[model samples]
Target: MFGESSGRWLDSELWHACAGSMVQMPPLNSKVLYFPQGHAEHAHGGKVDFTTRIPSFIPCWLSGLKYMADSDTDEVFVKLSLTPLTQENTNALLMDLEDGGDDCGNNNGGVVEGGNQEKPASFAKTLTQSDANNGGGFSVPRYCAETIFPRLDYSADPPVQNIVAKDVHGNCWKFRHIYRGTPRRHLLTTGWSNFVSQKKLVAGDSIVFLRAKDGDLCVGIRRAKKVAVGGGEVSVSSVVEAVSCGVNGRPFEVVYYPRGSSPEFCVKASVVRDAMKVRWCSGMRFKMPFETEDSSRISWFMGTISSVQLLDPIHWPNSPWRLLQVVWDEPELLQHVKCKT
Candidate 1:
């Protein structure tokens, strides 16, 4: 294992280029809609069988929240504690939805508040074969090197300097930044290989570089999403446990690996309440925003709701899962969506 400093200097908020910035953190102490079936699709890679009954949707309160990063991959995740809303309140919301009323929203609604500041300079690059291989060096994009890295003393025979940066955990990393590759390009040597190995980065995975206003360089990563071989059972089992605990009104924790491209199960209550006012019916067309698979850009997908019925009405009555079947206009892109994952 690589050593990590037990200190912090870099602001975690500035390191959002990878995934955090793409989606807002569900507001704290707000209402959210938790969809177990939607969560299962991402966890098991596709549709899964569930012997135990799972609710279609659980109206929950965001009782607790904490952001975390995987020690190995540096992938950011948010841990959440959710408590189901009272069944009485849920029924009232359903009644309001059926009545097409929009006044059911409560005042406990808003995003988490944070002090604003000048955002830092950040660059993201998808690791190429040469960058992730055993080259002992990483090819840096000219723009990134020139714009984000410190001023290089090109006067020397081979413009090079020692660069010290910190990872998400505030662990310091050093590298030899040089502008002397074959094509007169920038490169990271001396300490690049160790970072690759320790982070277990691959060609498809991405590395994010950030330079705070105080000139502290920070390194973060977004691991490529892969259907883990032999690990589906484990993920599915854990998700099921969380859903069970949540549906029973018991507090449960969910660790959301942001890069997984999973549907935001715990969605802000304000947004959900707004959506609840929609007269959802068959043939209703709608568009929703999604992150590109590369996490490089935001895009929209338009679809039409084919039906509005519970996925399993008998066993999972009033469950919101699969309640709406939509056909996307861009059916081809449906198979692959964002995360570089």
Candidate 2:
């Protein structure tokens, strides 16, 4: 006997159970990379310097929280502290330029603005022994060789091109680029050794190159962090202190500065999905990480999200990643804005 009342009650009960189990998950705070396309490595063997293996235009994305566990009644989260990797944040982490403090041995011209104009156009490379030695040549990444450097005449036996670049000090140097090797790698020859000698650069230092709005190439340097001191073993505390410090209720330091600037700093797709689960709204209080120039330490900047704006509709329409306009309590730092998950 088919009972209409029983069937109706059973269907209703099943619908309610399904609805209860569909409770939305909270947004996850995870790290991600924004890797651009077409920047793949060709050579692989020996001790590969992963730093050099990074693609051009890379920037690190550091979040202030990490996921722990979830419970039915309450969810658990862990606070994560990270340092800024971009040059502007690195300058803030290493020096105290804000209050007319001393410049912390930065050879690169005063910190340049890192807005949209600079982030996409700039690239960095860590110097290698071969780059600083009397070998008279330096290896150039494939992406830089193809997109950033001048065009090469492949018809020639070796396919060569000459590039004139200006350092932060406004000094110009000419470098010759040649495509050679079994897989045809790009190398900077001729004047590379001269530039290295003039700059007094050594292995472990980094060279940053930026294409100015005027179409001229500009270069800068970032010295590597010193590990050993006075024949004494490097302590973990000293290493942590070298990168960040707390002062006036703020923490500043460099967390992860990659050897190259690549588009890979964008958050991963899975991380984005987790982040989207959270219902974010304006006026939310958050602690953003930044580096202080005086100590090169990582610090936190407390601010409230003022508004959310979509990416340029011309290029990205209805994009899930939105720009966040953050207004810090300090008026001087009011202009800082970041991308939201």
Which 10 successive residues of model 1 have the least lDDT summed? Answer: 1-10
Estimate TM-scores for all models: 0.76, 0.36
lDDT, candidates in the order shown: 0.69, 0.42
Tens digits of per-residue lDDT for model 1, 285-306: 9786776543446778899988
Candidate 1 lDDT score at position 44: 54
- Residue-level lDDT tens digits of model 2 in 1-341: 11122111211111111111111111222223322221221011111232222232122333342222112111111222432345674344323322333432223332322212222344556678888896668888776667657678899998988889765334578988899989988999999888787667788665655556567765555445422211112223322332223211132322111211211123433344444445667989867664322111346778888877754444334444345677787745533311100
Rate residue 298 of model 1 by lDDT.
70
User: Which whole-number lDDT from 0 to 100 does residue 96 have in model 2?
Assistant: 35
Pick the TM-score winner. Answer: 1
Q: What residue runs in model 1 are displaced by over 4 Å at the alpha carbon?
A: 1-16, 42-54, 87-109, 113-120, 153-158, 181-183, 212-215, 227-237, 279-288, 292-296, 301-339
Clashes of each: 9, 36
